[model samples]
Target: MPRQPASFLPIADALRTRIRAGDWPVGERLPSRAHLAAEYDVSPMTMQRAVERLIIEGLLEGRAGSGTYVRTPRERLRMVRSRHRERRGGSPFRSDMAEQGKRGTWESHSQARVPAPDGIAHRLAIQPGDHCVRTAYEFLADGMPVQLSTSWEPMAITDGTPIVLPELGPLAGMGVVERMRTIGVVIDTAVEVPRPGRATQEEANMLGISVGDLLMRIERTYYDADGRPVETADITVPDVRWEIAYEIGIEQPE
Candidate 1:
């Protein structure tokens, strides 16, 4: 048997219709939960649930010390993933933002000599306890955070090299491919797997979105010319603000 929809779903649908009909204009505050509950003859908790559903769908937003309001629709920016980007030499992220006329910046914290756990070890083809350098980055466009990444690189590959710390040395803020080249490691290829997920409390706080908002999580690994994994990272992007685009190159017959 098919399960029936939740009681609040109908109310949510009605609220959505009202919003679309301009019952309240964009940026206008919604009526209080208690008032709506009384109007709908339901409990305040039920109305709250319905309102939350709209918020998650990007139709509404909540402000601290204020009330929920209709959300002003935001333009979704595209983040392109392609081999051509890697070949651009400088920071790919900065270049990406520049294409959109937005200033790109990031803050990163690198921890040295961290032990790799089982999952990270498998990704890097190293022992579970192998020492690695872990770096966490918050990427911003126009001073607003839009992406997050945590990367791990085997210390054995860069232990005594000048590029040991990703955010330090002469190539500070350079990408993985350029940084690895400084140590004689030729990064030739990369693989990325993207999955859809919900934002956790921590991720929500970082991205300034509601908990349980949609997110795109990408698992990426870079390989050397010899097929050895040089770096692995997990990247997070909020789906509400960004879209992922892939560029593929096709060769013509000679």
Candidate 2:
């Protein structure tokens, strides 16, 4: 058997070492692929893959026919902290928009008995195949789509509420928390879990973006006084429109 080419790691590592050692200063062009291949004693195809890996890692950028250059180290990510709890109000989506002087509206699509999705079922403490009243809505801020949400409530509890009514005005003026309060269920705390996910084809079309563009998936769950779960909502917001915040509480030494 003969030794093959096109493995990228060792080549990438060598280049990474040079860049980290300040051999290639910020905004400097690295040697061309043909040049790197000659220097590293590798074939062009193998050298190309190694360069591609660096580009994907944000350590390098390729300019068409111009050449590859070392990218200035840019912050990969940032977190915003707001100390005043008052600034962080209820309705994480709408409240933030309102704070920034953005008026928004919600258009309810429908509310009906539908089986919960696997994740929603687990959060709501319901069986995977169990029935639940699902409410879908589109949220708009300043006439622009901001978020799309679908909420699930176990049928046993919502069957007595007006959740299934045909009329499609806001389910309750005071929002989900208030509506549940009407049923003697008071939610004291809620948590939102967000993750990076690719927008579905339909979502990309509706949101005017390329299919599989980056998006944020938020799953919010509200818990009642007895520590029982009351509501679970899945929200999708465009990456440009929403920001996330977290509060960490410390426990005193026992």
Candidate 3:
């Protein structure tokens, strides 16, 4: 015999059907969990579990000191990754947001002369324990947190340079490609590998999503013209709110 579904799952399915049937309109408050439990003839705990599932599905939203409400649908934005964007000579992130009529901004914190951990050293082609510059970034679209990144760069390349700190100095906020160029380093390529993951508690807090929500983690590395790794970063994006799109160039025959 086949195993039975969890008790709350059927309840959740019924609630989803009702919501879709317009029993509660968008932005309308849902009835109390106790009332819902009595109506379903289930314990309050089971009702809570059913409601929480819908919340995670983005069909409902909870308000502090208020009841859960039907969520207004939101449009998922696209983040395009392409070499053409790097050639545009400005902040690619800002350009992306502007295309969608939203403002793009980021807050970053940099720590210089930090020792590279084993994993970071491998990515940057440096020895473990070598000094490096580490920067943490929180990116926002229209003042709402949407992405996060942490970058590592070898200190030997930028220790005495003006672009040592990613978000400070005259060349601040110019992205890795431009900043390295200012210091006489020509960044020719960047490679990114994306993987699916579940959000941890800390990540959930930062992106304003529930723990265990789906996310995409990207490991990106930039290389100089000589093929030396110059910078490496781990970028995080919430999968539900954003779609990662890649633009590839087709080579032309000479």
Candidate 4:
């Protein structure tokens, strides 16, 4: 689809100027939606959309049952993931964000048994139309969303096992390696390929950012010792809120 111009961009720009000029100082309440609509000669819906953009930009805050107001900006923080092989248990978030003074948390939605598309099936080395358990996750840092991830696992490998639901049962949230071990799957390796891209409107909305924001997209897969593909996931992280660093170890040859 061709890129469509959002009606709120100009409005957002105007409001941003006012905010930066101190016309509406931090903590000042913005005019009511109706008032702004009349001022801008647009519908209230368009005005609301404009305000929402500012809110996502950290320049405004909307109070529940109350009006929107200017918000004091907070320092932006970045999260890290170390590649040290020893750190292979529960989510890296627990250790990674914790060390950076943020409490890391994640919530997953219902797990579904669905037919794998040809591409996903190929990633898992399963037949097209084969069943897989799919789960979606939103990861947070100190209560603010930081990442979105969706994982698919071949039911042929996890069916009839406690680890079928990646985020449930005995080993919930324990990361992939430990969870697979419970079912006798020795996860020996994981592969990740990260690509940078601009976020679409849907993804922008979910991450509380404006459309076309830069983001890091990572595709990861886990393989067992026997070279069987067990799981794969797509992870998206907002570029403004995260920086990806790769740490590699060098080996000496005798």
Best-matching candidate per lDDT: 1
Model 4: per-residue lDDT, tens digit, 1-254? 99777788888889889998999999889889899899989888888888987787788999998889888864566654445532646777666777778898998984667999998999999999998999888988888888899899988888988888888787888887778888899987788889999999888878878787789999989899999999999999998777887676688998
lDDT of 2 by residue, 1-254 (tens): 89663367789889988998999988999877998899989999989988876775568889998999999653332222222332343344466557657775677655567877787788988888788777777777787776778777788676766644322335553466656666777777776788889879888666544455577888878788888787888888766445555667676999
TM-score sort, best first: 3, 1, 4, 2
**lDDT agreement of model 2 with the native:** 0.71
Better of 1 and 3 by lDDT: 1
Each prediction's TM-score versus the true structure: 0.85, 0.59, 0.87, 0.77
Q: Please give me the total number of clashing residue pairs in predicted model 4.
A: 0
lDDT of model 4 at residue 107?
A: 88
Collision count for each candidate, in order:
0, 0, 0, 0
lDDT of 2 at 168: 38
Q: Write the per-residue lDDT of candidate 3 for residues 80-138, one digit (tens) a residue.
A: 98998888776777777888899989999999999999999999999999999999999
Report how far off residue 176 is in candidate 4 (Å): 0.7
lDDT of each: 0.92, 0.71, 0.91, 0.84
Clashing pairs in 4: none
* Model 1 per-residue lDDT tens digits across residues 1-254: 99786778889889999999999999899999899999999898889989987886678899988999998656788899999989988799998999899999999999999999999999999999999999999999999988999999999999999999999989988899999987889999999999999999999899877676789999999999999999999999999899999999999999
Instruction: Give the number of colliding residue pairs in candidate 2.
Output: 0
Q: Candidate 1 regions off by >4 Å?
A: 1-14, 27-29, 42-71
Which ranges of candidate 4 are over 4 A from the true structure? 1-4, 14-48, 62-70, 85-88, 110-112, 197-206, 210-214, 252-254
The global Cα lDDT (0 to 1) of model 3 is 0.91
Q: Which 10-residue span in candidate 4 carries the lowest summed lDDT?
A: 79-88
